[model samples]
Target: MLKKLTQSETLAEQAYREIKQAIIEGRFSPGEHLPEEAIASMLGISRTPLKKAIEKLSYEGLVDLRSGKIARVAEYTPNDIENFLQLRVLLEPFNVEQIVRIPISEEKMSELVELVEEQKKAIEDNDLYQFIQLDAEFHLSLAKLNPNQKLQQFIEQLNNNLHRRYLILSKTLEYGSKTAYEEHVSILKALQKGNPEEAGRAMKTHIQNVENRIRGYQASSLH
Candidate 1:
């Protein structure tokens, strides 16, 4: 349920958070037009703040905006998602390979363990929003560990692009959250062993499985 906006940094920033959450949680479906007037009313704000929020979202690749036309949620075609996943298949494995070279500290390793455990709880509780967020946390956490800033930026971009799709698809594929959690565990285990080869392979498999799940769902829906 959307809450009424409370005074914070700025109305626009708060609206952005509210609207972005709605989009990611599937309340605002992809390609759906954002009726500025209605949303402004809902949040108890005027159109100015809402438009600023939309512009911010559009910049983040979460929303699509045109100069004169109405704003709409960003829609990723199959190819768009595939391209994102393919790059991830390359960069993320390399990310873990680098991580293994650093020999992640016991404390750092424990944090990763805790993160995945939180994911498990998110699954058991059927907390879709939290589950999706934690899924991003896992990847982004690993990406940050590497010293490569450019690589981190690239991975975050891909992660942001796929984030919405993951949210949408998870509702249709009820098993995905649990499956992704298990895959994370596999990657973590490989990392724990300090085996670069094994960790990279695990990462490659996890991402490929994501590709397959999305494609499988698309294929079945065609019938």
Candidate 2:
């Protein structure tokens, strides 16, 4: 039988979730200091438990610690983002291909549909933060369907690294949120049909569109 979480475990998990959510929502921007004291106080927990949470975040590649410097959020370069996208394009499609052979449960499909609706609402309301959150959650939940804990964990790390940078990119572009919603719908439809090829193509195209837009924006800002 599986063990239940105790009080300390629950507190630490809560701290980790709150801190991770804040980081993903860009409440803590790249290279911004994450003071243990401040974070502990903010989460209403002792430094010890908060420290444990920070360590967990660090293991997930979301937090960075420097000698004689406070820990800060990790920043991704354009090349880093590109590399990540390439890896995702390779891995996720294979996972989706495997999924085609298995029947997806109705409950899982319904949950994903609800997530898509949430993303649509966020876009319509221009809630970029919430839009981004639901977007990441949608992808993370899809990967979790694979039943491979290690693979799911790796994908979560990749999503965390991309989430902030993607949000930054999305904010500067015209109609980014709208485009994302549309693309998500396309991907969802392909997944619903269990067409791995179509789903993979849509996913790749969506990511590529964001990448192109971000590069264009970056270049224009420099000019």
Candidate 3:
């Protein structure tokens, strides 16, 4: 019984991760109904475990589960985007400072470099989705170096929304990805130097650049 229960819990966690990834990747669009039966069929899991997974997503603000309605992907308005970016500007630089205060292993730094290389290839190939995934991974990996589980979890949650916005922006703006790649390079270089203050400043500047781009996008869209 104990083994079976553990296996079931593991399956539920797996289902949660897969479903969350699908939502972040825009497989399930904002406000789209998530039918339990269909998702279970697609994932080859039973509704019980899938329901548990959906509930977990709801807690993370990725899914909306009302009392009498099917779960839907959470939608963000322009105002929501602005608010999220503002929060990111506050939290992310602090995360960088915390991360760089500790010594980063050579292996971890090399992994980040590999991610950047993958991102460059994705950009060359015009694979926007792959680039976006790597972009999030790059920053989140830095945050993970801080050794604070709660802070890392909070940053991951923010990245989920940021990833969605990045996909939308990438489709609409021609130069956004190129600019972001440049900023990532700057941040990585600062980290490699093992300068905590420089890394934190680089992170702040990178996020501010993102904010500027989003504001510019919004301004142009209004015209």
Number of the top lDDT candidate: 1
Give one digit per residue, the lDDT tens place, for model 2 in 1-223.
Answer: 1122246567778777677667655577777889888777666677887778778877766788667788888765778767877877767666666565565788888998999999988877877667867888887887888877877877777777665444543343233778878888988898899887888788888777767766776687678
Best by TM-score: 1
For model 2, what is the C-alpha lDDT against the true structure? 0.73
Please provide TM-scores, in order, for all candidate models, with all chains considered together: 0.88, 0.72, 0.70
Candidate 1 TM-score over all chains jointly: 0.88
Candidate 2, run of 10 with poorest lDDT: 166-175
User: Taking the candidates one at a time, how many backbone clashes does each contain?
Assistant: 0, 0, 0
Which of 1 and 3 is the better model by lDDT? 1
> In model 3, what is the error at residue 3, expressed in angstroms?
34
Residue ranges of candidate 2 with Cα displaced over 4 Å? 1-28, 37-46, 147-154, 160-175
lDDT per residue, candidate 1, 130-198, as tens digits?
A: 787788888999988888899998888777656545445334334477888999999999999999999
Span of ten consecutive residues with least summed lDDT in model 3: 1-10
